[model samples]
Target: MNLYAIVLLVIVLTLLTVSLARLGKVKTKADYLVAGRSLPAFVLIFTLLSSWIGSGSLLGGAENAYKHGFAALWQGGGGWAGLLLIYFIAPRARKFAQFTIPDLLEARYNQTARLLGVIAILFTYTAVVSYQFVGGGDILHLIFPTVITADLGKYIIAAFVIVFTAIAGMASVAYMDVAIGLLATFTMLIALPILAHHAGGWSAIRTALPASHFQVLGDFSFVQALELFLPTCLLLLGNQSMYQKFFSAKSEKDATRAVVGWIIGTVILETVIVAIAVVGSVLFPTGEVHERPREILAYVGLHGFNGSAALQLLGALLMGAIFAKIISTANNWLFSPATNLVNDIYIRYISPEASNKKILAISRLMVVLLGVWALYQSQHIDSVLKKSLYAYTIYSAALTPVILAAFFWKRVTAAAAVTSIAAGTVITIFWDTPFIHHNVPAVVSDRDAIFPALIASVLSLAIVSLFTTPPTPSQLKPFSEA
Candidate 1:
């Protein structure tokens, strides 16, 4: 193969080997699920960063910037807003340590709430993982067009991520994130100035694209921006993966410290990513990138690095890092639902007395099964932006409301939580369905699922809780005291 492809392939192999080496350490259920609750601030920082900045930001958000420019920050801006809230909640999350989000739901509400929590996570996380396959496949096609087509690349991506994640569990996922986090940070920071220079500076970018590209709203309406912001914000606020990572933290301080670092890194890197896409807009233009704009960053990488440019090697490194980011995301998202399957369903309901070895075996099996399922979904929903938003809305609308109530409101009753979840989940599923969508008032039907679903969820929580009895003191103790 080409030297660039070879070099990047080597980097991928190295990361995989490092992850595989961590296998010996994953001996218990805690080790597999939460890294034995041993992650420190530094490790937590990178893992959170790497996990958050995935195909959605790299491919989908970049595509938005490719067309809309800086205004696309609304997508990542939502997470940034959510991160501020996460900083306050991190310590409490650590104090309330658990293996999965359903565990928290069951504790705060009831068994039905827990089962619904698991169902919401399965649907949302699998959708999240699907797009990662699409992104990785796009990058692979760029590197090895002759040998591995994009469709083929997707299958390979799913297989590798499945096995790699199954091998070492959270320990490898957390620590391997260290390398990915550093590489992505350095690559994006370095690539921007150089790519801007290559694109003939900021003035050139301004002249090449629409003026709206520079505006806060960019040609999008306020509602459109809100559509992007709400899902990401809600997802971050209720993200099981983040809480899981917090549970993995060695202490509350470590978890809290990590959030500060994660927020700073997210803001900078997301801005830099959009900047890269905007600059790529200047180089590749509308007709080219628009056809598959999500590949803008990959196109920029291939062009910037493969030739006689001064930053050629660094460009390839950045490209490799981007690819690694995709794989890392796939690993993270795919691993999450598997955790839910094993912890919430398998162990909790199927085999509570199952031994550690038996549990770990089933955990790996779940990873493979979920990865395959995600891959299947990716094949059907090829549009990354649509899939990403759809997935984000499901989790944001369904889980975030009840999850926040668990910590913030003792008046939230079990019946209220259960009803809220069912409302949110059902609304999100049928918001775009042809039969239901066709019959609704255009005002409600025309909007994205976030508004309708979130409104229904919140209203159900408030009104239903008013009618039902409040949560008992014991349920409020862990949340209030911690």
Candidate 2:
């Protein structure tokens, strides 16, 4: 397939996404933030699936599969664990009826806690958005070398993301996701199998690849696996984006059912992507695809299937699906943080007396600011998976436990909550500092921000609660009774 044609197809699809977003009426704070809290089961399921699977899985997961084989499944598996955890908590989160994760924390803790939590969410979520932009730009650069030329491609890609996201908030993001999620799933499941069969069979794939590539555990030792395991599990426990899906659902049953579907969808789709990468490694066998493992889907689509017309169509669909996944994820990550800025930070602090109209206006403005910030940061980052881990760690380590305690533990005081959150967040930032990362030995130094953050949060919660006074009977009544 010609690169020019592919670039044109992407541009057209992007325009269609923008057009659909404009059709929705984004008048209220609820509409802009959570689709008016009226999404049915199907929409909620796809939105959750699409938002979670984004550039990280399509590009970064494939990259990991190429480099480390089946071990990459651990990263995808983390979300499955998180969804199960969410199943038990979704009803409560939905009952809270709040706009942001910080809102729940503030209700149980204090304003200071909310402020700190917002700062952490914004920093990390913005970084996640930036890396998605980088991944999309890489795709554009690969397909249309002239349009996304060496000097200007980054700017072009960033500009498109900013414009699309700034158009209509979650109103736009949700619908786009539904369309893309279907495409992405079909692309991987249908296309990859045909490509595999054409390249010979499962037998051919096994014989062609290194023996180690087939091992489920890959090269990771027990300790190294734990390093990957803990952070992912912690992040899953309280992911803000997942909560956003809960808030958007039409009802409790819809939210719960959607998440169940999400688990099944993630397991199947992620496994297929990994399988595609393994097949690519076997057939290519020269590491020629290493520089852009994310493009393996495209490479297989364009070259691997020889002369079959049906196979070619499947390949195109798969390629299109990967592109859809990138855009949908980018849209959600870019939009959700803006909701936090408006509902939790801006409306709370900047103008507490502001009307809903003014709040919605401010939300749109912040979306532009955040979109530009994401674009600027996109230039320096390289890997979607790494950026995602950093973002997830910041939220999971610092905020998840604190939020959990808010609903489940009546003894949790504002001071204890604040201390735990602050300590966890500070340690996470310190662990990621250049000096700290460089000085630590490779065996001990993996970028598991959740480690220090979760430890500090837990210790701070325990020690502070033990030393300080617990909430009074009146103060504890609401949570205790509920």
Candidate 3:
């Protein structure tokens, strides 16, 4: 993990990514962002899995598990629920041929709805990118401590992400993800079992840790689990990153196959990572573990398998794979919102006549700007899961219900859509504000932000749609035909 090795690995990966992106001949707007909507089943699945898991799943989920034991599984389970739900929604989403979530909203509702959706997306997705930078900085600092200072590490990571993302957008993201995902999957499958065996087996793990760490229900009450479950479900309902993957698929069959693959891949990989965290908890068995859960995977690399050089090499491979996952997720998430902003919002509304070449140039520039902003924000955030939850809640509350209504309920009018999105987002922000903090009970306050946001959004959608005039026959025709 010397400075030269780290730099060489990063340089090689970047060049490979850029080279693949150049192969695609991005002459049009579609090619630049969504790979001209031609991603095949395997590429789509890997990109979806890699993008969703990101730094949040690795660092954030592991940190939660280290601190609260088995309750952390709830976070990963939310994704499982989401993927199951997506099984039915994926085909339709692809049928729409929309570039972003806001594009779908704009097509079904109105420009006002699109604008509101964009606002929420930018806020939340930027926060998501911030956590990625934090994760990247952590990885860099861990591997090259003496040569790569923390400040320099953040800049290096930001530069790497920005450059990779700006080159041919989703084309680059998807192709690079194929390689990164395969590497990550193989490395995890190989390393985790070895790490566990070295840690002395299931019996030793159970003996070393408290009984609650293995509990299926965790320490949280049924009601508390419900609170956690609802937000994650809602967030996944209209996750823009997931939808983008659907749009990128080469065919309807590819989209469906990819989602099925995503479910299996996500479940298996997430379970392994969770097991790694649990094993680390058993081996370490101390309060200090909470502060450095990011190192749990790294710790395995450093100490998990001694004696055999083969085991140690497997450990190092796992570490590199984990690092790749973190970086890939960051690249995709950071790029998606900016893609939305540039194509869906900026090109559509700000300057409809802007040429594709100019739009492409601006999209690249935005990646750099976003990377710098994320790096600055990452300095203040300590918990990746909390930041991710906050971002997920904003998108879930404001857009999920409205997006679902677009597919199922023809009565959902533009006004209702706008109001629901506005009310949900505004209320959630207010709830988190200092003005209401003193009055809300600790139990309610401690729960995920999505609860209140979902309630407000759903109620507004139902109430407003019920009271107001429904869409005209023309508007209902498309949905009715489906």
Provide the lowest-lDDT 10-residue window in model 2.
3-12
Best by lDDT: 1
In order, the Cα lDDT scores of the candidates are 0.91, 0.74, 0.78
Ranking by TM-score: 1, 3, 2
lDDT tens digits by residue: candidate 2, 9-66: 8745775666465545877778878879988888888888888887777777787787
How big is the positional error of residue 192 in model 1, measured in Å on the Cα after superposition?
0.7
Listed in order, each prediction's TM-score against the native is 0.98, 0.92, 0.94
Provide the lowest-lDDT 10-residue window in model 3.
2-11
Candidate 3 lDDT, tens digit per residue, 1-482?
Answer: 54325543864566465646565587787887778999999899899988988877788877767656767788788889988989988888887777898888877888899899988887777788888877777666766768776567777877878877777788888888887788888878887676677679988877877777778667777776665566567777788988888888887789989989999999998888888888877667654345577666655555566666676566656667777787788788788888877977678878999998899888888888877777778787867777878777887889999999999998888989999999878877677776666788877776667777788888889988999998888776655553
In model 2, state the lDDT of residue 180: 78
Q: Report the C-alpha lDDT of model 1 over 241-346, residue by residue, as the tens digit.
A: 9999999999999999999999999999999999999999888885656699999998888886555645677878888889988888888888988999999898
> How many clashes does the backbone of model 2 have?
0
Cα-based lDDT at residue 244, candidate 2: 83
Give the better candidate number (1 or 2) by TM-score: 1
The deviation in Å at residue 5 for candidate 3 is: 3.6
Task: Count clashing residue pairs in model 3.
Answer: 0
Show model 2 residue runs off by greater than 4 Å: 1-24, 437-443, 472-482
